[model samples]
Target: MRLQTDNDMVGKRWRSRALTDDEFDALSAASPEGGFQQTAAMRRMVEQEGAAQTELVGLVDADDKPIAGAMVAYTQGRFGLEGSIWLGPLCDAHNEHLLTAMTMALHVAAHKRGAISVSCWPDDVYLRRTSDGEPDGEPDDLLVGNYEKLGWHHAGFDRGYGSIVNRWVYVKDLSGFKSADDLLKSYSKNTRRNVKIARNSAVHVRRLDRDELGVFHHICELSSVKQHFQNRDLAYFEGVWDAFGDRAEFMVAEIHLDEYLAGWQDKYAKFAREADRLEAALPESKYPDDVRKKLDTARRNVESAEHRIADAKERIERDGHVVPAAAGLFMWHERELVYFSSGSDERYAKFYAPTAIQHEMMSRCLERGLHRYNFYGISGVFDDPDDPGRGVLEFKQGFNGYVEELPGEFTLPVDRIRYGLKAAAAAVLHH
Candidate 1:
């Protein structure tokens, strides 16, 4: 594919072509904002799964060194063939000429490959944000304006959770924090309390090897059933593990049965002693009714603690020493650590295993000297109490990170008539 650009870039020499596996890996690793999604391994996984045809398109300078690149996955969409779903384009944000040239080249290549439309979700590094971390609003409009000038249509801000990607994300800056304690100080009080609870409850967090994918998938299945979300099959997760390799880590939280049971038994003993003392003094106490009620509550607590101890003992006898409670997969790229996906067992929710797992991951990020930790995607709408994603936002918010609203998605139409026909057919089919 030849380079296509406006007259402004006429003096610049640009070459557009397919990048080899080595070239793709080298460039993606060197990209300032690229993550695992832009890697050659990811493309290979997509192709191997037969879900899409992968293409690594690069725009090279006169020296033949790539200045900008994208991993475009060609897949069948509801409306015709969707070509070039660019997760995050790897490019220099400050170079307008290079950005335009690369955008044009991608569209040209997509059209040649019979793609009806090409859409892109630019990397978040290109967005401008205020010191307070909110979207800079009009100042950030320049980023989308550049794409529009390249003949791409702004798809508008995506408020719904369903379609599109990269509308909003939660990010925590880890640059200033020196230790886990320092980072914990920045978290909300509730988050801190929950983490403490999990720690005191003997919830252990550890990294899982690839061989343990089954264990992680089991927790994900339980989480999916409880959260009302569809769970990806084990094969897909295996592919992800294989693709990212060292850059990825799957961490699972487990509760040690012996320790947990012992703690419950100790609590039961303490509550029993307190209940006995309260009952003995109930008749002589000035507030007789109040003392009797307190005694009753203490007795109930002792019974509950006893039940928990018995349950834990039974589980230990049948299942062994530890029980998995929650799991999360993380991807580390350059100075950023991304929380890619996570799931937790609803049965262990009372232990706050999920929060504890996240805390463990954040500490690891700090130890590695990562500058930022991304919580990935979240719906931007937070004011509405009834929004389906409100709980997600609230959970992420407890980590004390600021919300980042990206420029959103944009599309360049290659075959308007075919696109329209397919879209109409899809609408009718859905109706």
Candidate 2:
């Protein structure tokens, strides 16, 4: 048989090469469904990932054409920690072949980054099943499947231990250790009033900008320093500000505590004030025993609610991005709204912005025909009830969102021997 005269038989489109960082950014920025396309954020992620010791790889086509990209991160300096490096971004055409190539790209990216193996969250990646019925992949549906096809070992399923499934952790060890789902189940019955208050409150939502970033960052800084964590710089916030585009929005729930609600708060305050008046008028020696206890109770309630109202008022006048008080990042996907990140103004912890935001957003999501409103991440730090961070967990607990055991991280072995040696050296050094 005569050999083919032309080489166009390989692909409908010519097999152009890959993509570099600049090309990747241009493609992502031009995409309609892209998220956070700001250059600063990409650089920041690159920097942070580097600090985490991740290998950030950018590829390109034969004529310097940028077509695809991926990241490789080696955690704890162990082969176990080394894996496909990503900051959770997807912006390709997303068909079957392109999908598998992305998986293959992961292998290349991580391997080039010095990882003998790579790990990732099983993000809708297709996995094929063995004759024994294990899920393996062709990379046709998702990335996870490609790993299996490429001879990457399976570590099994896992879960997210919080309100939103984003923070859900999954571990697949080419080095031989995987974390499973016995770790995931459901939500506890313990919730708080703020959750409900935010759930049921009236608030508005809008995407803010660098102008408003200062206030948001102020709150974040206060919360961070109070809790002992490092906060990123203004430049980083600006990147998030630009990248989110329409997707990046903030909410302001006008607890409009109607004249009616305001009246109620005032009425309560009046009662306490009158009691105080009585105590001041009467000498400690002259006041009745029950009167002192009653007066103390009133004072405590007022003090507790004092800041919450002020916060609501400030949000309405200054921010206009308020929620019932339980407000957060509402992840919207295919008619499903997930509650991602959440926070409350200390002044209105009594009003429960946390609950207000979740409940209201849930209603909005449902109205928008979304099936689920996810409360993103939660604290596993509750092992000690008194852990200072325990309060944040409790704040999340108020909403009563269902706990989903999402499959966590998984990995594939690339340079097994090198990875094994790295793992051993790490364990010994750290040990």
Candidate 3:
């Protein structure tokens, strides 16, 4: 091993060679108590997307003893991130301090790579939190306490860079956007129910197969240029479909509309314009006024097409998407099925697509012996009723889940003097 960083009493020894797949696997297996940033997922991400020249590991301390396990340099869509630091198959005091030192080492590597910023997920804290059944806490609370005691703003959370699944994207921003409380609050009671309603309505969740992928692509492509559409390529979905398919399910629920059974009634008379075309091709005497009137009526019906489209949308929801009173939900995992995304024909508003989806999903999961009914996401977080998207905020709040607050993000600058101040700030705001 070759030495890379030192902090007086602590000296970081990096691997003399790059990690091979076998080495990565062997060491990770040895560290059984690993997580998000230290597991196979992190390995795949680093190997696939990160710059390997800067991936850091460790060797010794001031006593010159070897440090166990690994560290990684990760990136996301051109953004630099500090990742996985595992403490072998065990935990110890040295693990904590060593991780702190490793993070600094990575910051040096990240900044040198022209990275605008550097960050890590802090997997050890996550393992503790998840294992302890405590999902509610600030982003930087555990670590931020130390960071605050130093001097950097380790408690910065960019709310707009939020996730549909609350707490999924805990972040520490180095530039642009501050933490917005609106993005942090838990979903409201009624909004949770709406998600339940959608799930309870006997909607079946199915991933789009290869054949259906084309249709989804078409719809998505057309939607992308809309005033609100974001840039996403067909290849992106294909990759996600491949990865998440093995671990996460792609689910879309469908409800059958029964309105068609009582459909197709019109006040206007039926007419056709074929005769008019033929008449125009023939002698003028061949056409009659009655035929002309019939053609004109048909033309008027075609011109009024938008109204029919709207009517159909309303009928589908009113007659379809509805669940019987006793129906329940399914498809939740880990005792929770989040209604992360849903959409339907607007005309079926009465059929309550949004409401049915959530309710059905929750009910199904509950039947399977699950616990929480998550409505997933909400925006806008002010006591003032005048905040933009207050309606959406109020809607989600209807579900009656706990309103949780968390500490935000913080950064440990690269230089030792700067990092010391960052640690000071962490101690102040947190512990």
Candidate 4:
């Protein structure tokens, strides 16, 4: 702990200091607002990358118990060493006193480290939004005003993804549901049908060993190319796995080609038997019209099953005994489970493997007694059908979740002279 400051606010005294890893972990675990981003594991990941130096700064009570804090990553840039506070200061964000003290503590800590300025994208909600990105009620304008009053420069609410962290996200509240069936009842009809399709198709989801990260990476890369999105390198994921251990899960949905083919073959036989029975009964039935209609439907089912069986056999011959169709990485913190990065092989998209992967993770979340499931980022545009992100939004919405619009990023100047100089230079370069 380098610098300690004593301050009095609202007739109570508070202190700020550098916290140890254990201290930070305790604070994060105890606070409902705490998340994966502020964990000691996150700090370890930053260290492993070697691109930034991480500092865990906290506001403590008289007993030295942390009331609020953040994990700040300092990186040297062309302007100067700049600090970033991502998804934190973990505390009751609505508490103005704590927020003010946290702001002061960050300034002191960053300046002491010779940083010119600090940038923060606090993981605090500015609006409660419906699945369609429309406001559920009123916006939290007071929060923005409070930050500005605390001497932080606020970026006005903007549409789309234009910040280091997404200003918009989708989350599901899992507290009300008691079982997987209850959870399934909440999903859209299409989502439920797709999940059933994947399950009936013999797609199985399992946790991948660390050595199989290359498999996940390959799927993610393929999906990224098709979706036109950037993806992290393998080392980034490996670092996460090493740091978070069991708290991190890399899950893949796979199909045993032989078993899948067998399943289809059985379906074909069942459909053929039903159609044959209906056709034979039709000649003697007084209700011949209804019997003929049933026969037609059953014949169509048999044809569909035959086609599926043929496709399965061809896939088995070409792709070997087992084939991975989709992969997803999930981070489990005490408060919630975050659906992090994911990828799928487009060739097996008809398998609906991603839906199965999501279902499996959500079931695990309910078993763990967690209340929140974060589906993560989405572009703020919800109404435009032609928007590039429409498909992404629709996919998440199928699971029945709401949207959260967070206050955009803010910058707090540590050293006014250096910060001003850097800002001037940035403006000049842009022009």
1 or 3, which is superior by lDDT?
1
- Candidate 1, residues 275-375: lDDT per residue as tens digits? 98998998789999899889889989998998898888888887788989899989877757888888887766888998998888889888887778888
Model 1: lDDT equals 0.80
Kindly list the per-residue Cα lDDT of model 4 for residues 1-431, writing each as its tens digit. Answer: 11123245622657888999999988888786678888999999999999899999988898878888889999998778999988877866567777777887888899899999898887778898999777898988887777787778887788886547888889999989999989988999999999999988889999999999999999999998998879889999999999999989999999887888888788889989999899889889999999998999999999898888888888888987899999999998888899988999989988999999988899999999998999988999977899888887999999999999989888888888988998899889999
lDDT of 2 by residue, 71-91 (tens): 344555533346543323342
Cα lDDT for residue 404, candidate 4: 91
CA lDDT scores, all candidates in order: 0.80, 0.46, 0.40, 0.87
Query: After best superposition, candidate 3 residue 198: deviation in angstroms?
Result: 4.8
Root-mean-square deviation of candidate 2 = 12.0
The best candidate in terms of TM-score: 4
Write one digit per residue (lDDT tens) for candidate 3, span 107-135: 55555655434433332332212211235
TM-scores of all candidate predictions against the true structure: 0.85, 0.52, 0.49, 0.95
Give the CA lDDT, 0 to 100, for residue 57 in model 4: 93
Local distance difference test, candidate 3 = 0.40
TM-score of 2: 0.52
User: Alpha-carbon error at 220 in model 2, in Å?
Assistant: 1.8
